[model samples]
Target chain A: GDKVKQSPSALSLQEGTNSALRCNFSIAATTVQWFLQNPRGSLMNLFYLVPGTKENGRLKSAFDSKESYSTLHIRDAQLEDSGTYFCAAEAPGGSAKLIFGEGTKLTVSS
Target chain B: EAAVTQSPRNKVTVTGGNVTLSCRQTNSHNYMYWYRQDTGHGLRLIHYSYGAGNLQIGDVPDGYKATRTTQEDFFLLLELASPSQTSLYFCASSDRDTQYFGPGTRLLVL
Candidate 1:
């Protein structure tokens, strides 16, 4: 039983297309964070949510604690967006440790 | 401009050898974490510390030891490396919110 499950293990998109990645948490998650791991393996934090939604640039993220799920949306994808996207959640009963999903590898082509 | 830097971006060692991965954060964050990324498992926490001289065990603590000597530095030590230990190690710093990650270190145990 995975505490955190991610959808669409992999994705391929056109440069200007849009896509959404999701994560479902079986545990009672209080906080959720999204990250992008580039091809060189550097991880960049995209958003940290405590319920509700947040947007930056062309990316938007939403976390619903009651639903135990989170979503990351990319509008107008770019070549730089081609990477593995991961969502991690911190459970209310856990020891402040984060449980990460298996990640969604995204490939953007021109 | 918070930065979390990991040393020895890449390393190769023989089995039974000892390896030390170093992490330093200039953000003066209170929490520091060590994680390993495998093929299927996106990122698994190995160890973490709230501050200097305070160490906490993570989900996968076996075969790994960690030390937080100062607020700016945290280190992960492997007394006896194995092939299974080969993975991309990431160090992160946080203050109960967004986590800033390092570029990650790729380790190969022969």
Candidate 2:
């Protein structure tokens, strides 16, 4: 079984549309971080949450430690946003080590 | 912003060869990590260190060795490479909260 399981393994979005990706953690996660791996093979940090919600531009992310889940919401998507989104969770009593989910492949088309 | 860089962005080697991938972070982060990404498995941790001269085994550390020589530099070594080790490798640096990833190194073992 996976410690961090991501939902909607694949997603397609039209330009200017919105979508959400989710991750469920079997481990008791204390924090969550979201990353977008672009076509050029560069991973960019989107948000880092600690049991709350964060909004940056058209992207928002929420982490609920009590429920052991996290969600990333994207609004007004663009073609440049097409990439693989990964969610990583940090468990309690660890030294900043993270367990990653399988990730959600997102394709934003025009 | 944290700046993490990896050398030899692309590499090709024969089986049973020796290879070393290097990573350096400009920011003074305390934690550094190494990960591999494949087609089916999104990403798996190989090794990590909280500081210089400290190493921690990760989920998939069978064929990997990592070392944190300094606060700014970390390296992943493959003493005997295998075809199964062909994958994209990433290095990350964190400050016990948000993590920043490098551009990644692509290795192909023949």
DockQ of each: 0.87, 0.84
| Fnat per model, in the order shown | 0.86, 0.78
The 10-residue segment of model 1 chain A with minimum total lDDT is A90-99
RMSD of model 2 against the true structure: 1.0
Counted clashes in each candidate structure: 0, 0
lDDT by residue for model 2 (B1-110), tens: 99999988999999999999999999999999999999878888899999999999988999889899999999999999999999999999998888999999999999
- True lDDT of residue A34, candidate 2: 96
- Cα lDDT, model 1, residue B19: 99
lDDT per residue, candidate 1, B32-87, as tens digits?
99999999988999999999999999999999999999999999999999999999
TM-score of chain A of each: 0.96, 0.97
lDDT of 1 at B109: 99
Backbone clash pairs for candidate 1 read none
The CAPRI class of candidate 1 is high
